[model samples]
Target: MASAVLDHDPPPKHLDEDEDNDCPIEQVRLTVPTTDDPSQPCLTIRTWILGIVGCVLLAFVNQFFSYRSNQLSISSVCVQILALPIGRWMARVLPPTIIRIPLLNWSFSLNPGPFTMKEHVLVTIIASSGSGGNYAVGIVTIVKAFYHRGINTMAAMLLTQTTQVTIFTPLNPPLKKKQFLICFFFLRSPVAGIRLGRIVQEILGGFSVHVCDSIQCRALNEEERRPKGGLSRLQFFLISLGCSFAYYIVPNYLFPAIGSVSVLCLIWKNSIPIQQIGSGLRGLGVGAFAIDWATATSWLQSPIAAPPFVLVNVLAGYVILIYILMPLCYWTNIYHARRFTFLTSHLFERGGAPYDLDRILDAESFSLDVRQYESYSDIYMSTFFAISYGIGFATLTATLSHVFLFDGQYMLKLWRQATSKANEKFLDVHGRMMKANYAAVPQWWFLVILVSMTALSIYACEGFGGALQLPYWGILLAIAMALFFTLPIGIIGATTNTFPGLNIITEMVIGYILPGQPMANVVFKTYGYISMSQAITFLSDFKLGHYMKIPPKSMFVAQLVGAVIANACYFGTAWWLLTSVPNICETDLLPPDTPWTCPSDSVFFSASIIWGVVGPYRMFGPGSIYVSLNYFFLIGLLAPVPVYVFHRLFPEKKWIRLINFPVIFGATGMMPPAKAINYNSWFVVGFTFNYWVFKRHKQWWGRYAYVLSAALDAGTSFMAVVAFFALGNYDIYAVNWWGGVLDDYCPLANCPTEAGAYIPNGCPQIQ
Candidate 1:
């Protein structure tokens, strides 16, 4: 849907009438400063050194944690915070020496006055190279761990490089129509998806940037003073951060059960049915809550940053999907729902046993064996996992239709305003100032880079032993897909802070066309998915520069350099662990206490098995049990129609306009990884800060809401790293009391609800 409430926001009159307060988006008008400092230096010596170091540090730390079960991603916010004091220190200690290249007539200074906000922003942009954490590294992990195959370093590094680079360029049209025929053969039920995709592309006419990032960067630039008797922004942030750091030790370590305590589980400790209703991680989570910010905002994020309506709509949708619909389906035993646990992501065989994935795969080729598969039972999943996919399917179409119906014309206006010089006066004052001040990066840069990367991407898959059987034609389709979805997805992500991926769609297409090639499927999925996501990141960086008034050419240089080094470091780190760490990611072979499970990569490996090896022909093709779910396309396509009509019927009813089916349906989109505690706690905090406090205490909320969010994130990242090293790494230092367990004291939540179901490992089964 329209990501945030900024589409048609009325400009506020708090600022002086003649000032630069005429930005179309209200949040930007409110947060970004009206003036610029043209004399302030941007690309100083402090910027490059700090940026490069931050990029390497983040890449190493994040990749290190990726293999552990308790994964902690260090964000660019961390660099934004940590680099400030060091930057100020460098500004003081370094000599004011001028360095000039006489041949090129270029000059720069060592100590460029006090470190400027523009410099701080440039450093964060550089660090952002590793912020998304190299999506292609999972290919290295899954191949080494799951497939047990050795890869060519050149091939792996090329795959990593291409995925890390995000580009948006027009491509040469279909070379041979014959290749299109082969792709078309694979488009069966996904043909139904054509309308869904068309719905999104129909209204792709605007550009936006991450609203939350804008809010966070306010600290680095703005010079406003705190009111009388109020804490300064830095003091308030440090206080809140200290509190966050100290408070985490309780719920995250000493008293873990408080992280997600379910009242029903505590009251009826022995009742499986009651526990099933209350278990936060593995069940319905009827009365669950978490005190820990890490647990509460694990996947949902700190709600203090979201708009009130966004939080309410998401929570409303989550309750309907998880509490009402899922429980009903489970209780009634649809598709043998009770045969599995309530909230698991695991696949199962019939009769309640875990699916033996290796049993159906050919050992040598890593492809599905029809003979072995015929003897084995059909694939089954928890009702939660199956239904969630159906929700995702509907959400895509709903997102497309909702955006088109609600936001199309406004976005079209923005596109026109952005492109034509005649409409430049109507543009935001910030945009006008940026254009006036900075030399723009030449368009030819993108053209040259796109051609070079596309060529390398092809050679990475095809030239390497022809092992990755993705033909050159597949790359063309992938680029086409990425170009099509990038703008639409970017709009939603920038506005709502929610980014939906094309991994599923990409895998479905290639797996169907070229089944039995695992690397090909995953590599293609990486290309299709990461291209759009990284491109969005690239856009967000530019927007950050846009708001901060950094020169476009300087920003371009910073990003290009950072991305290259960060991509290399990320690959080097993953490759080092894969080669040196004994039995890494192999849980059975490692010691009982080993912490190298590669949880995300395990899921990635499972996807390769599901889509690549077995292919859609077996999973969702004709005669498949899930074939019925293909109708979600029709359901989603029609969902937004009612909302659109209602708005037309009664334009005065504003709340009706706020009702977004995609936001609600997509609320449960992160369920496989996110628990109910995340959603429930997020909604409560968001409502308190953004709604109640926003109206009740306007001054305080405006000054501290986003600052508080940033502090909490930074503190949590720091503590997580400390906790991992101090206590989480060893059994001896871990808390020994009953409170140490993180679950809601609901052991039975792992068991099946069906009367005659078999339990794995001979766990007690109900009769």
Candidate 2:
């Protein structure tokens, strides 16, 4: 929930298109469409036909792009836009004949009158729901590609020493269709958080990110509520979209150096220390910068959408942790830091070689081979990677503490207000219309879903002959975990847009209990953590339905049907890609400059090995080298207390409340999947537009900043897909040239400092 304090639109300095904000925007001037048609056809043939088409297409497209190093997709907004013309055309061309079924006493028409806004909303709900890529699919990637395959992409850097060791002794190399099919049933729970989130809600909720999406509907929808001058929103959006699309080709395919230009690396090309300090991908990235939107917005969400305060707070923590703390830990050779690379998520041996799973892993049990492990070297990490774990431990506790300290009153007030008899009075026209015009979905419907999903979850866990390994009681415990965190997480999310995930806690808990079983740990975390995320998203969709005045029953049907169909498509698409893609997630087998490197899946696998296979006890238990990192949890818990006290003591100093420990600690959470370049470039862009522009040109910033962010995302995503199809995928691959790939000319950055340490290809031995 670090992004919980990401951004919020304060009291508007200027009026909306047809609005004067005399009342608070949250209270009275919410951006929901004021007018609605009670009789507008919502769940007609048009919605089903169009929704299914969009859902299936997006499900395929999103899943397809996810494996790329620079992931991009045809966004749901694109579906929203494309769905309009197709929807309208279907309404016009289809037969208007009505058919009646006398036995059931039901009647329906093939053509619903001009595709209504409610139909549009339902279509969107269905398609977007389907396109939310399944998170549990990562388990498939880990199992099929990383663990059982005996080869996986290590990182951007490769080792000279050769070893092809499967992380798992033997599961199935190719995941049986049944294994992934089980995950599909659970995909109904957490679609939105898996792939994407809406932008306007993100800004208001304060966690809007531009990652995974090039085109966003949030800006368009919000801008529609505002007055247009000169170029219209669409006109400006299209223009920027075209510009960013064209510009990305340069950095993305042609001159990759444009994406990350480290002056220090360029100036001192032969100096190992200089390269180590300057490489954006491999090293500290002290003076790195990028003009590319993809790199800038990859890790952190769009800076353009963030407020000045949010950017500053994040920048403060980033500089302090990365610049100040990381360097100190690494340079001082703490924990034998000099034995490993300067910064990386990959684990290593004490002797500075990649940790060989073949040596220490028990082939039969998928557990640690204690005897072999003792004979082999202990697992170690780069100083930065080690610190990242400490940050994660701290972030989880800090999120809860920060919420109670700062937003407790607001939350309590909201709860009281919600429970009070006067709650009905707060209902706006949209809410009242939803209540009056639509029959509410019965409570039993939810109970049925809950019971059925629970049963399926248990079956997924244990029905596979203990393959998934989670007990039935473990399923209940997971649900209970979700139930426990839901209210607080919901409150924190509702109050602040950021959702602090329970992945860490869940992993820690399950690791402590079920140490040897790797599958159980990740599966438990998925149900506990990802389940809560999906629940929040489900609620958010309901809120949107209410805002659009869609029938409650229609919304329910759309969501359920969409989840089922979309999830199947999501699974089918992923299965196809996993089976078909040559080498898949294994960079060891793939050709150089290949785009099929699965960075996220690699991180997920690392996490499974650390938290699940080895167990947290082995990694963070007593007698472990990094046991002190656990103290960060306590540190995170109390970190907010001082800030709260300071805020209380000096009521005048408004800045103290901005100190978000969750954001600070959690900032590095994405480090492995993300790297130094992503963070450095993201901070630069976020600071530029949010702080510099917001201060100097509030009017322009308010009008076009969000639009530009969305447009860049849209343009970049479109181009990426195009580039992949045209040049990067299949036999074509990225063109060979100095400009064809991203590099900071810092080849020695990943080299270790200790004597006898070595790397592959060009990486030098330290001796």
Candidate 3:
């Protein structure tokens, strides 16, 4: 049986000529699989297919309006709110395959099995908790302090960092996967909180006994396992909060030294002892200095050479090969392995049941099977990108065009799957059976939420510190866009998030195109803030995938769903909150002095230069610094030019290995040298602590460590929120229980001065 399973290899793929499978132009076929297993029945959902089509169509339409009416603001609310549900519905109904021509066949299907009530609640909770909102709120608090309370940028930064690490960091763990509304409601409502606790006890208490060893499974009946062999809930929570507080200090004060050390430690500690981490760190350091040197030199020489050199630096062969080429190939395949092959395998073999090995091995068996995607040929790549670019441009063409390209497909596929299973259970040849682990979420609840969003937009008009305010037209457009653009962004396959609406808004407000619009000013002012929020969501998804053992592809798809839903729901609620509560938008609850107040003049001039002038350096600003460092360090190692010259001059000895090691280290040593050191330190500390407790003393710390960390973050956030409200951060309350003492005795330690609390304005901006 093992031999047979191993022997089954799909057929060598042929280039697909299907119209849908053709390349778009100037794009590389990064993901091309050369296998085809035909025995399995095709279960492609059309919703995703339609969703992609809808996005392209809508993008084209948006482009048309952008050109004709010369207004891009029409699609803002529409694109953000309903994109996920639309995508989900489309994926359920659309054909599952997304084929491309030229020696490739890959899967981009939208069959994630059945969803359950727990999954729905879990997703909604996670989406709504304002995961990104915390960052936005932090920025707002700083800005408010700077402008309203006459504080400088340095002081504001310090205060923000302190507040974030100490207060908000600890609270994230318990609330990470919950809905934002639920968190607020429970925290605010005493009666509802009590009721929820009772419900949890009644349902879960009886279930804990059988699985008493797991806190997550505390629902099982067993008091012995509950909080046993570990710290109590309160203790764990505080620890997480403290850790979060510590995190704020590292980036500012410790990054320089700690980064390189961490890399070096990883190299020393790893079984292979490769200097991969070290090399990456050096790249960052060199790149940072290189920019400074290049900028200084270019001004001294001809300015013409600057543009070409800048482009060369960015698009250099080494940079492209290491960063773009390798990751595109490896990550894409890894994504497939995780999403299609890994996750579904468990489902196929559940309960010692026999599965159709042939069906399971089919190349087209996965979601969004694209038969034409085979090889990384140049022509194919160019064509694929052209199509993508075209779709983006089309968003500015006509509204009808917008509907065609951006419509959701995955949602459609799911809907059909549900319908099919309603009539017949999954059965394979020889009477074997296939089943889903969880049941689907009820349709009624889904519909009710949809209706509720619509109702709120039309009526309530505001929500949550006046953070939400969608006009009727905006809400309508959201419904339409969501109906179409959902699947491509949400599911697995050859779909896309053109970011068309955002582009339109940017061009209108920031560019020279549109003359005036009410929201245009606001859009320009907040675009940078918004981009960061989006970036965090993307990175968080990647991190979650790394930890949860979810198939990479499935995680990617799941994340898209989570992201789209959160973007829409969060924005809508924010709008409503703003409209409901007047003057709140003027305060620290939201970032003030943005483009929203004056669209035409509030162009993001500084941001434009940051993007155009110092291109690659921008990645070094926040979450992206580590990745950039890694890539440049790779380039430094493989640069060959200097090494070749040195080898020629000294022909007597063979020191290639030694020379290679130094060069690699030099490059890695440049940027994040501190990271390596810190990582090593933390690892050593962790291991030593573990050894002392577990090996010598015979104690287990695993039971409590991770949970404790998570609890601490959540607990700290809870306290911070209470403190923020109480200390007059917002208009919630006026009595400061700890404020007086902090001011008198601990002035520098988070005391609220006339310029607001805990801000240190000493650090310089990257630019």
Q: lDDT by residue for model 2 over 1-767, one digit each (tens)?
A: 10011111122132123432332235324443355556567778788888888888777767766787665544456556556667778888988888676786566788857766767777888887754566776766777778773222221001100000000011122333122100111223411121011111222232222221212333433335435446756667778989988988887777767777888988997777788889887887879877788787665556665556656666766777778888888889888888888877788887888888778767766676778877887778777888888888887788788877787676566545434555554344444444455554543555466555565566666664556667877766765676555555665555334555457888888888987677788777876777766666665665556555566567766777777676666666766778887888887797766768888788788777778867888788999988989898899999989999999999999788777777666667777777778888777787777677888998777667766776787788777768777875556655588756666778878777787764646776666
Assess every candidate by TM-score.
0.86, 0.83, 0.28
| Colliding pairs, model 1 | 3-495, 3-496
* Higher-ranked by TM-score: 2 or 3: 2
What TM-score does model 3 achieve against the real structure? 0.28
Task: Return the number of clashes found in candidate 1.
Answer: 2
Model 2, residue 132: C-alpha shift (Å): 3.7
Q: How far out, in Å, is residue 190 in model 1?
A: 23
Which candidate achieves the best lDDT against the true structure? 1
Candidate 1, residue 428: lDDT? 60
Report the CA-based lDDT of candidate 3 relative to the real structure: 0.26
- After best superposition, candidate 2 residue 110: deviation in angstroms? 4.2
Q: Which pairs of residues collide in candidate 2?
A: 1-500, 4-498, 17-227, 205-497, 214-713, 214-714, 215-714
**Root-mean-square deviation of every model:** 7.8, 10.1, 26.1
Q: Candidate 1 residues 1-767, lDDT tens each?
A: 01011111122223224665677666667666766665567777898889999999888767876775445566777688667879999989999897776786566678868888888888999997766688889988988877788888888888888766544532213222111100100000001122222122222212233445656566555575776888877778788888888887776567767778899988997787788889886787889887877665665546776667678778787888887879888889876898887777767888888788789878777667878888997778788877877787777787788778887886676555433445435446765565455444444555566667778878877897776667888877776676666656756765566666446778888889987677778888877767766666665666667677666567766777788888899899899878866788876686544446676787687678767877767777899867776777678778999989999999999988878777787887767666777676777788889888999999788777877876786676666668767765454323767777666778887778787887755247677
Candidates ranked, most accurate by TM-score first: 1, 2, 3
